[model samples]
Target chain A: MIENMTEIAISQLLSETQKMKYEDYRFVTASCVSLGDDGCDVIYHFDKDLEMKHLKLRVGKGEELPSVSKIYFCALLVENEMKELFGINITDIAVDYGGHMLLSDEELESPMAKQQITIVEKKGAK
Target chain B: MSKTVIPFGPQHPVLPEPLHLKLVMQDEIIVDAIPAIGYVHRGLEKLTETKEFTQNTFVVERVCGICSCMHALAYCQGIESLMNIEIPDRAKYLRVLWAELHRIHSHLLWLGLLADAFGFESLFMQVWRNREKVMDIMEETAGSRVIISVNTVGGTRRDISKEMLTKISVIVDEIKEDLKQVEAAFFNDYTVKHRLVGVGVLTKEDAYALGTAGPMARASGIKQDLRMTGYSAYGELDFEPIIEQDGDSYARTVVRLKEVYQSINLIKQCIAKMPEGEIVVPVKGNPNGEVVSRVEQPRGEVLYYLRANGSKTLDRLRIRTPTFANIPALLHMLPGSQLADVPVLILTIDPCISCTER
Candidate 1:
């Protein structure tokens, strides 16, 4: 069964994550999504006993969010991915890649950001 | 002894996908292993932002050719939940049938690759030869050997008739019979035991703490399987998660080998209990909410998070592939391992770089 989506303030992200860890929920994965002009929403998924609990944090473009990599070591990969792909300024990640983890030096910068090229659809008579 | 650095992939004989592991070795033992991925990242998740939700099934299926059906399944389930459409019972059984078939083929493929990793050439060929039967079944049933695009948003695109189901059942039984020899070789063969046993061990604690999934987690005695969640028809089926406590490369191999038989049994049960109904239901309106769908892929549990904004396209399509989740466990298992065993250890996790990177 699906659990209700829980929205938490950016300030409560760490404390809530710690509580989940104390409750023995396995850190599944973290997802970062661009919400256009309304900044971005970072959802952290955790699971225990086959039930899922999601803790979401919404932040502005220039906001520096805290990383949960220290609590959930596996979050390193996803955290670095967010920093590189979406330009999310994650603070004090455990195994920080300095913005070069998944992407290369030559690729497009922060492709998931709002200023990225928009994919336009062309209509044609078939 | 002086430390030597070895770059493991991005192009390697043993790896079919590009995953570079920077190995820091002290003589014959690897002290550390740092993984560098993204060599083959196609940005398929980003593509979902542009492609229509219906069309993205094909795109997501290409995430990994090996576990394409599971990828499609997860994406379709998420979209179906968003649209609040109940798939037909027949479609659910058909999905389980095809999913089990995919599992069997994927395990067989890993068996072949594992055999090849340890220089068991003839055994590798035999395992793959058996795998061809499954591939042929998929081609005949789904019209594609790899990347079967049978799943849509509401339901499946193809339906298997009772006659075809009987044919599949016969083939599955034949496969089970053929697998005895393969299982025997994996269990009794000296070379395989010597190379795999007590190598690349990850204890139960490390397995959970690092969040490993699928066979890797099962091998470590976690008793974690997404199938237990009962997405689709798995809840209706009678089965148990295969577990091994040894938590070694050999244990991982055994888990997968036994799971192949488990998948065969699951398919037979699905055919016996499959309900008769329409395969696809009409789904109207756009998805306006978010949903996270989880499915048990051959490698592990794959999570697809889809957010729709009441549009034809999705706002975000995030895939937490099994391989990506297993990377931390890989990093943990690498150190304290002999340099020569790196290939076998990497294969033990069934590293799908394309899936991980995408």
Candidate 2:
């Protein structure tokens, strides 16, 4: 259930990768996010002409996608930050994860998850 | 030789922001430098998507207070590009005026901070005291001292009157005289040279390979100023990219000092040639495209990328600050310097860890 706005059905991942590379877009980083219903969104950020472009690739909730850290040195940190923040798992990454700078293990219920959270307007709260 | 691990930061006096460094040392000489960031990460990137496009101007401005105006300007430029709005010619020149004022203030602030790191107390106070004039000018004109919230999506929110411009012109002359005194202290003084002369050397090749930006790269002989792209009213004005041959700490200081004069000159020209027009355009509808904008901030080059999906809020916004690109270069330079010179050397890159971790 990809919510992408791409024109075609991007079934061939290798061809898409080749197409992106051929277009001269340097792969900057890929970050993972967990969605409900056994689905996850893997966002790949690329840069060319000083502009950042995001492409979302979805996988099963427990599945893994390919890593681009081999292509860009900056990706390792992005993948780690996403894993720590969104409770998504990344595989085959080279550098140290730096062990989750912000959150602890028990609080990994995903603060960023799109769930029912209170939004009390300050004007009427008191 | 065994490589002993020595921790360099997280609370080092040399760095303005908290950046942890684990250095592998052989006796007093460093062999490798491993950097650990996120010490001050406030998740600014995630927050930008949540904030309204107008409000993000303030949020992003706080990304680095030293380069606040530049941050806001870059964000505005991206939004303007998306909207296909051509700001008035007068607004363009006004943007240059305020932005150059920001550059001057940021560079002087860095010079003061650098002097303090070297224990040159008198020089530090002199530079910062002179910086107050720029702050006063900013507050008087833009309504805020540090995070001057003048930049808007289509143009700027504030407009300078003819009287304000005359006052600003007088202030610029006063600040230029004071900068000359500060420069004399930095260049002619024996102690500053003794400490910073040969410390933290990065050759031109190393700087280029590591993608160092701003004065750090310029000091290493790379004349790649983004101002040459003719963004804002810089294309209409006459100026030159400041460059230096030496890649040492002192050379970086020289480059910044020279840039202060360039910024002052740029502002003077803008004031002289500024025309009368609306400060901003009426921005309508939702911006719906991906646009990239680059601006030369005090530390180096700052890149802002904005992606909108035809909404009031942007879908994604990413900032690649100069400090972020310079960190890798610092990793290469930190090794091989003496232990005591770590603070001085660390400061040479003008590491804004907040900007990096943001």
Best by TM-score: 1
Off by over 4 Å in 2: A1-94, A98-126, B1-3
**A12-106 per-residue lDDT for model 2 (tens digits):** 44456556666765454444444555555555645444444567667654444444454444455655555555545455554645335444333
Deviation in Å, model 1, residue A46 alpha carbon:
0.5
Tell me the lDDT of model 2 at B114. Answer: 84
What are the per-residue Cα lDDT tens digits for candidate 2 across B1-358? 8789988778867666777888889999988877777667776877887888878888898898888888888988888888888988888898888888888888888888889988988888999898899999989998889888888888888899999999988988898898887797788789889888888888986776555788998999977788887899999899789888989989999998988889888988998899887888898888887655778888888877566789888767767788777866777777778877788787778878778767
Which residue runs does candidate 1 get wrong by more than 4 Å?
A116-126
- What is candidate 1's lDDT per residue for A79-121, written digit by digit as tens? 8888777777788888777666776755546778765421110
Residue B348 local lDDT, model 1: 94
Candidates' C-alpha lDDT: 0.88, 0.74
lDDT tens string, model 1, B1-358? 7899999987888999888999999988889888888777888888889999989999999899888999999999998988889999989988998899899889999999989989999999999998999999999999999888889888899988889889989998998888896778899888789999999999998899898989999999988898998889999999899999999999999999999999999999999999988999998989888889999999999999988889999999999999999999999999989988989999999989889888
